[model samples]
Target: MRKDKITSDELARLCGVSQGTIDRALNNRPGISPKTKQKVLQMAKDHGFIKNQYASSLSRGTSNLIGVVMLNLKNEFFSQLLTSIESTARSFGYTTAIMLSDNLEQVERQCVETLVGMNAAGILLCSVIPDPAYGKQLLQYSTSLVSLGNHICGEIPHIGIDDCAAMFDSTRYVLRHSYDHIYYVSPVLSRSSKENIDAQTQRFKGFEKAMALQPSVHYTVLRDPDTYQSILKSIPANGGRSAVICSSDSYTIQCLQLFKNSDVGIMGFDNPTMLRRLYPQLSTISYPIDAIGQLAVKTVLSPVKEQKSHYLAHTLISGTTIK
Candidate 1:
């Protein structure tokens, strides 16, 4: 027998015990003596036998893998969220397989198929898919799903921020500050070759509702493919104190780049840690993204998932950008 990659049976033979005894020791299951387990573990480690629990789970028709699907990694908020989810999942002894949908419905559908085929225990999706019927179809596979940023399906619980409420409050904060003009910046609609998106769509709706509170206030919804370019032309040349509120911090940061110190009040949603630290003066709606990750892991892995959804509180930060 090779010294490397010792099988469980081989380890059992070397330890002079039954294969079941070795199995119990490696898996830390009951019915094995501490001394025996310690010896088996030490021996296995000495021989470089790292048990493949993932493969074993597949054999047992179960899984300890969490599937996480989202849009691209370029978005600061999504990147931060992914890290939180990964770290939280690991604490619960579950590994994760992450896939990016690139904001395409077909790509998201394929990602779901692949994760399901891999026997994933749960899928945490920041969904891009447009149809709820597809969500029902996934349920047919008896998969446990939880949504983070988007509402891929209403059935899936939301463990993230309430985009509508947060954005509404943020917009109101801007209005209260008395900016003469407000430019609402968002990616526009959730559309795929097929679909916030789960939250992104709601965010715009929230902004609209908030704007209605002051119908007379001059506001422009800059939601084009080239939204930043529009911003340059949209702001009044007469210099009436204007403000630009983006749906996410990524967009807010982009504005800072385009119009550095130009005196346009810039506000954004989702105060991501890195960005916030780098641009502390950026006004934003701060959501506990880290907590969202922890809750998502617990909700998905729980045997009884009684809670259908969650709405964590968001704090509005009145930073220098508002002035």
Candidate 2:
């Protein structure tokens, strides 16, 4: 049979099995021997047989596609999360359909409508908008919905790190190292819209609370547009030990380069690879990216229950940057 024309019948013939047996094995239906199933699957793989998921879904009245909606992929953290979510979903015999909202509520709504219209099996959303009303409207589409990172809708199951606690710990870690000044630098909190403000706000609140406990320690928040220049000037002129808690790894790396010759302590979030290489000794708060992805899929597929949120823990990884 021609490569492009290879069908289930051709695969069955090559495997010395009936078409019925091939169907059962390929679809993972019971009643087929393990040996026969393996042989059929191997033959299908060798022949480059690609199952038509859309056609199969149409026949079964349910799609195996899991829809994922999140903010922009400019941040390495979100990109890593998307990769983990896709890989985890595929391991369970499901495919992913991804959409980006660029932190716009309207764009996020449009993505949701499109996924709903396509009858996606479930949706894993790192919601740009934190509006419960919009989330309620999404529930009318009849697909399982799970929130990632941010709790956009209170009713939906959410999987995320506790931003407040994570930041609070990070702040205290830096403080304990004899840093007299703490600078919380976050571009998002300064410029993001309401749809993208939840996580940043929580982190800021955590940083504030930690600073409040140490009244003698000087602290300042540097938003975007001016943060870079401000850090460059402040760290050197402060005349004392100072530390910067960057909102993300990208920002942390940027600050690291700026302070490469200075003695400023730096801490970053998400622990990206670039940060690891640039400053393997950089302190960071590690988010459970893989666990978040796996749990998001699990929550969507599991039966509905009282569990509305799953806040995974974050770890404070110490390095030379903090000391």
Candidate 3:
């Protein structure tokens, strides 16, 4: 049974309650009785009504829809963002529609358009679209939009850490030690291809800037996706204290699998929760997920969008992986 087959009034009628009671029960409002709430939920389930936010939006009202667009939810960091964003949005009396771009331009654009068509009150985007023109076009759209992470969308104000500074500091951490060689791992960026996220570029800029101060230090940029694994493997692990700094924890997790307890030290950004179990000793930067996600919802739902990008502080965790 589809959700549309059962309206709020129909469910309320079957449950022997007013539509108001059903609304409170559906939204989990405190005014509803526990027994009534359970009854309503069971009825909803038995009838095959969807329990997703999209289904919730019907009862809450379409005007309260908050659309969230993300690059992908394959990693712990972004998944954390989803949980935080949805929780925060719900607290603000809004229902969210989460969509994925899979790092594709066409898909991301389609997602934005779909939300716009749905009359979303606002959109929170962590985009993979490579063009700034689309962002400028978004500026003219009727709905409010706030970039969640990347800063590439036409001077869009994004909620992100000082990526350059974060990487710069991470690089310096390895540099502070006697490490003779450093290799920075990042997804390759192709402007013509639009295959990568610019947020990765900002991190690289930071690493590059920090590396510039120490010309004597041997540093290599492994930004090519296809070649980084082979190139990283070919390098002699036994050489003078070498460190490989990964741009993301997802990539670092792979490196952790590849290197295990080798002499080559590994460092990753945003120590993902799963990584903690897999490699407790891996050093990483811990960015504030709660702060970033809450702020993203606030900025996107505001009457006026934020003009300047916001930066939050990040924590560096030192683990035994570097030693």
Candidate maximizing TM-score: 1
Candidate 1, 232-268: lDDT as tens digits: 5546464789988988777777787766757888897
Candidate 1, residue 16: Cα displacement in angstroms equals 3.3
Better of 1 and 3 by TM-score: 1
Candidate 3 local lDDT, 1-323, one digit each (tens): 35555666678789999977877887777898799899999998877655455555454445678999888888889998889999999998888899998878888889999998787888888876666577788887778887876775645678879888998898888788778888888755544266546677888888989888888999887867778889878666446778889988878887887787477788889875666787777788877877899988888888775577788899888987787
> How many pairs of residues collide in each model?
9, 0, 0
List candidate 3 stretches off by more than 4 Å: 1-62, 153-155, 190-193
Query: In model 1, what lDDT does residue 256 have?
Result: 76
- Which pairs of residues clash in candidate 1, taking residues 3 or more apart in a chain or in different chains? 150-198, 151-198, 190-195, 191-195, 192-195, 196-199, 196-200, 196-201, 197-200
Candidate 1 residue runs with Cα over 4 Å from true position: 190-196, 233-238
- Residue 298 displacement (Å), model 2: 2.0
Model 3: residue 281 alpha-carbon error in angstroms: 3.0
Better by lDDT, candidate 3 or 2: 2
lDDT string for model 2 (97-198, tens) is: 999988788888899888887778888887777555876786666688988867766777778889999999999888888887888888777656565577
Name every residue pair that clashes in candidate 3. Answer: none
Better of 2 and 3 by TM-score: 2
